[model samples]
Target: MNTTPSYRTIAGDGLWSNNLGLVQLLGLCPLLAVSGTAINGLGLGLATLLVLLGANLCVSLIRHWIRPEIRIPVFVLIIASFVTAVELLMSAYFHQLFLILGIFIPLIVTNCGILGRAEAFASKQPPLPAAADALAVGGGFLLVLVVLGGLRELLAQGTLFSQAHLMFGDWGRGLSVTLLEDYRGYLLAALPPGAFIGLGLLLALKNLIDQRRAAVAKAAPALTTQQANTP
Candidate 1:
């Protein structure tokens, strides 16, 4: 029995089955707060991704040196350090976006998702696997952020990628699209309640897809046996 997990399994779990935003539902505070627009979500998501990558790799590298008694604190310190670095970098380069994100930038340190990955998978895995896990998990979270943000933004303002210049340069100013010229905005989709509702809908959609896949897999073998016995 090959007890070792494959990269496909790790990626599958991080991207879909065990997603931070959709499945595990970790880091919802930041996820919901900054996801008012696609750019806001993209900004925060990239920052979180950077921190996760750095923290996971560092934790995996030093796993052997850390004492079991103080591992939790050690992992937190590592995550905090990476979060600080990400915050500073964003402030310097994406100043406008940074100011908009405000305290949430530093709050990434408290994100249970990052800490959970460090203690759960990173601590036990090698550097390569740890980094891969971080990428997969972070990517999954990023996808949800961008998708939710875009949906909210479109519903509320009839625009996608509004204020693109905040992240991209002057050229990005042209990226925003006015999908609805005379469209009346929906106020609810722009509020906190909207975030919850949107996320719930997304969760339901994912569950529906998963249920369909499960049904198909279950029927496959039985169908094969029936066909073989028929003729």
Candidate 2:
């Protein structure tokens, strides 16, 4: 049995075909909660990415030694350890963002996406592929967070990257983009319902694109055969 998955397959799984945030719908708690703005999402996303990368690498390196009966606990420990390190790092550096994220920072340990990758991919694959998988998965998650956060912030506050200082210091304060001038924002977009509605719309958009791609793929062979026969 080939225990290792190819880097391409890993990329496909993480980025598009089976994204942690979009496809698998994992980690929605923090995804929906703290993603009220782009800065908040970026901060949490980076923290999660850091934890996933570390946990995946560590699990791959030590996978052979862990007994199957205790693998779950071992995985949890590995993930929790990395999550703690990330939380402390954020607190030490980006104190404002850290305070905003609060318990969700520590709660990355409970994100099934990180643990799932460790157990499913990292545990079976070599370190290189494991790392690739982590990057791909983390990248997909980061993209979703940024997009969703941007959307919500734009709708709620007529601005993008609001409070960028929380993540990027004072210089980042200038990164905020104003879309609407002298206009009040939608109240719902400032609430949890906005996250749900935005997520649902995003999911529908992805599904629509997927369906179109599937239709094109399904017709290609038939069209090819018909052309050959006519010729």
Off by over 4 Å in 2: none
The TM-scores, one per candidate, come to 0.97, 0.97
Residue-by-residue lDDT tens digits, candidate 1, 143-193: 999999999999999999988999998989899999999989999999999
lDDT, candidate 2, equals 0.91
At residue 185, candidate 2 shows an lDDT of 91
Quote the lDDT for 3 in model 2: 65
The Cα local distance difference test for each model comes to 0.94, 0.91
lDDT of 2 at 67: 100
Clashes of each: 0, 0
